[model samples]
Target chain A: MTAPIRKLRVATTSLAGCFGCHMSFLDIDERILKLVELVEFDRSPITDIKQCGPCDLGLIEGGVCNAENVHVLREFRKQCKILVALGACAVNGGLPAQRNRLDLRDILEEVYVTEDGLARGSKIPNDPELPLLLDKVRPIHEVVRIDYFLPGCPPPADAIWKFLTDLIAGRTPVLGHGLLHYD
Target chain B: MKTSNSEVSAQANARGARAKAARPAEANNVFTIDGREIPFEPGQTVMQAALTAGVFVPHLCYHPEFRPHGSCKLCTMKVNGRPTTSCTLPAAPGMEVENNTTEINDKRRLLIQMLLVEGNHFCPSCEKSGNCKLQALGYALGVMSPHFTLFYPVRPVDASHPEMLLDFNRCILCELCIRASAEVDKKNVFALSGRGLKKHLIVNAESGRLADTDFAPTDKAAEVCPVGVILRKRRGFAVPIGKRTYDLKPINEQADRFKPLTPLPKEEF
Candidate 1:
C-alpha cells in the first residue's frame, strides 16, 4: 500500500515588471526538482496549464500599475489561500516606483501620443480591452492583503526555496538571522 | 547671625563626617571582556573602566567629565537575548553579555550608514578628514557608500566664533557639543532644532546661521564635537588617515570589549 499524495497547487503571475523575479526563481537550479515533487504548478508559464485556476499559493511578481494587473491580482487574492509578494517590485514598487514621482498623463503623452510618437502617423482608438494606467506604481499590499513579502531587487533564490519548502512541510519558516532581513 | 554661622559650621562638619563614613574603601565588582577581567572604582563608566582595563571602546559623546547619553546608539550590545545601548546602563553581576552578534554588528553598521547619509560627510575634501569620529566609525564599520540618499541641506559655516568654525554639514548631532557647552562651560551657546529626521544643531535661539550667532570661538561646544563639524579653523587634516581611529580596530570590536558598567533593559524587536 502507498501513502496518498497531498497535492499542493501553486501559481505565478507578473504585473508591471521585467520578469527578473521569474529568472531568479529559475535560478533555484537543482532545488527546482525538489520543489516540483512537492507542489503541483497550476498557472505558471514554466509548468502546468497556462490558464489561472484555484491554487494553494499565489506568487505575485511586480507592482499594480495598470488596470489589468489590478484585475489579475484581485483574482489571485480571491482564488489562492496564500499570496506571496515576490521581489522588490511586488514588495516596495522597486525601480518602477521611481517613476511614481512623475505625472501619469506626462508619461502617456511622452510615450504614446506625442508629436514624435506612436500615435503621430495613425489614428489610435481608445479600445475597451486596453487597461488604464494608475497615477503611481504601488506595492501589491497597498491594494490588497498580502500573506507574505520577500523584499529584494529579486529575493535571493534560497529565500524563495526556504519559504516554499517550509510551507509544503507544514512548518513555520524562520528568517535566517540578519542576512535575510533587508530592512 | 552668629548662631547661623555656628550652625552652618556644625552642619558642614556633620556632612563631612557622613561623607567619610559613606565612602567605600574597596571596589565592589569586576567584569570580563573578550577574556580579560578588570576591576573598576565605583561610579566609573564602562568606557572609562574599559580604558583603564586597556580595552578601547570607540565613542563620540562619552567624555569622563560629563554624563553619558547613548544617543548615537552605535555602542549597542546583545545581553543574553536582547539588544541595548551600553553607555547609559549600569554594570550588574552575572550578566551574560554578547556584543559580537551579527545582528548587533548589522544594526551598528546601519546606524553609521544612516549617520553618513544624514550629514555631508565628504571625508576627502574636509579638513577634519583624518581625526573625525564619524569617519572613524565609517571605516570601522567598513562602510562602502552613504547607502541612503543625501539630504544636502544648505548649512552655513559659523566663522563668527573667532577661533573655531561650526560647519553643520559635518555635524552628526551627537549632542556632545550641546551638553559640553551647557554643563561644562556654563554657556548655552549651542542648541538643537527640528525633530526626528530633521533634527540638527542651531548655534543660538534664533535659528540663525552659526556665523550670525553670538558664539565665542573658545566655547566648550566647539572643543567637544567628536567630528570635524566644530573645527579649530587652522588645524585641518593635521592627522594622516593611517593614524586615524578606524585604523586602530573595528568599532564593533572596540565597543564589545568595553562592556557597559550598567546594562540597560533589552530592546523589543
Candidate 2:
C-alpha cells in the first residue's frame, strides 16, 4: 500500500490585538473536532508552541504596532507556505492604528506621567521584556506578503469556516458581497 | 419682381424655420444608460433618473431630496461621449450614457481613496459601520484598503448635542446635512465655511454645538448623513454585526429593491 498522507500543519497567532480574532476562530466550536482530523496545530495559542516549524497554513491576527508584532509576522511569513490576514486589524491596521494619528511621545507621556489615575510608581514600564512601539501602526501585509485577507473586524465564525474549508479543499476562497464587509 | 401668393407664404415659412433653428434643442425625456432605456421626468438629473430606473450609480453626495452638489465626483459618467457628473447633468432624450465602465470606475476608486485619506474613517470602530453608505460603496468597489498613504487627519468630536454626536473626522463633506438643514428643516443650521483642504461643516451657533441651535434630533439634517459623521448618542451598535444592513444584503441588491416602477415599453433616448 502507498504511504499515509500527512495532516496539514496549521499555525495561528495574535500580535498587538485583543485576541478577538483568535476567539472568533475558537468560535468555530464543535468543528474543532473535525478540524483536528484534517490538520495539526503548530505554533498556535492552542498548541502553546514557542516557534512554528514548517507550517502549511498560518492565520495572523492584528497589525504591526510594535517590534514584536513585526518579528512574529515576518516569522509567520517565512515559516508558513500560505498566510492569511485573519481580521481587519491584520488587513488595514484596524482600531489600533487610530493611534497613528496621535503623537507617540504625547501618548507615552499622558499614560506614564501626566495621567492622574496612573499607579503612584508607574513609569513608561521600560524593560527588556517589553517590545518597542513603532512610530506608526501598519497592516501585516505591509511588512510581509499575505496570501489572503478576511476583512471583518473579527470575521464571523461562518466566514472563517468557509475560508478554511475552501483552502483545505484546494480551492480559492472568493468572498462575495455578503462575505466581505469592513465593519 | 412681382410678389405672388406662393412667394409670400414661402417667405413667412423661411422666417419661422430660422427662429426654430435659433432656439435650443427640444427636450427629450428618454435616455440610455449602459444600453438600458431610462425614462426621466422633467428637471431630473441623470443620477436621479438612473436611481428611479433601478440603476445604481455609485455616489456619495447625490441624495434625491437634496439639490445636486456635485462635490463627491463619484457619480461621474460619460454622457454623449463627454465626461460629466451624473448628479448635476440633466438627462436628455437620445443621450447615450456610459455609467459602468472601467475608466469611470477607476476614477471613482481614486475619489474614494481621497475621501478615506482626507478623513479618519475607522469603520471598525465607528458606530455607523454597517449602515454607512461610504463603507458599503467601498466594499462594492473592492477597495481592499485606502490605497494611498494614510493622512489620518486629526479632528474633534462634538458631543454637546445631548442626543446627537458630530464626529467631524468621519465627514466626507457631502453637504447633505447643509442642504437638509436649509431646504427641508428650514432651520439653516449648517454651513460649509472653509476652502480646499480646510473646508468643513459648521453649526449655526457660537458654541459650535448642535444643542445651541434650534436643531432638534428629529430634524432632517440629523438623519441625512450617508456616513458616520452625524450619529445619535446612546444608540451606538444598536444593531449587532451580521444582522446589519450591508451585512444581510449588499449595496447593489439593496438598491435593486428601490426600483420605482414596473416594466415600461422601451423608448429611444
Q: What is the interface RMSD of each candidate, in Å?
A: 20.8, 21.2
Indicate the residue-level lDDT of A35 in model 1: 73
Q: Please provide, for model 2 over A1-183, each residue's C-alpha lDDT reduced to its tens digit, 9 standing for 90 to 100.
A: 121288889999998777999998989999888888889999989989989889999999998999989988989999999998888888778889889878999999998989999888787878999999999998787788888878787887877887888788776675566666676
B155-244, model 2: which lDDT tens digit per residue?
Answer: 878888788889998999889999899988999998988898999888899988888999888999998899988888999878986678
Candidate 2 residue spans exceeding 4 A from truth: A1-9, A33-41, A53-56, A80-82, A113-120, A168-172, B1-29, B80-83, B100-110, B237-244, B256-269
Q: What DockQ do the predictions score, one after another?
A: 0.02, 0.20
Q: Give candidate 1 misplaced runs (Cα > 4 Å).
A: A1-4, A47-51, A113-126, A175-183, B1-27, B30-87, B90-269
Query: Candidate 1: TM of chain A?
Result: 0.86
- Measured by TM-score, the strongest candidate is 2
lDDT of 1 by residue, A1-183 (tens): 121296788999888877878898988999787777677888875774657788999999988888888998998898899998887677656567556546777766666666474544544446888888787777787778887766545666776777677667766553342213221
Tens digit of per-residue lDDT, candidate 1, span B209-258: 56655566677776677787888877765776445554454443454443
The global C-alpha lDDT for each of the candidates, from Candidate 1 onward, is 0.63, 0.78
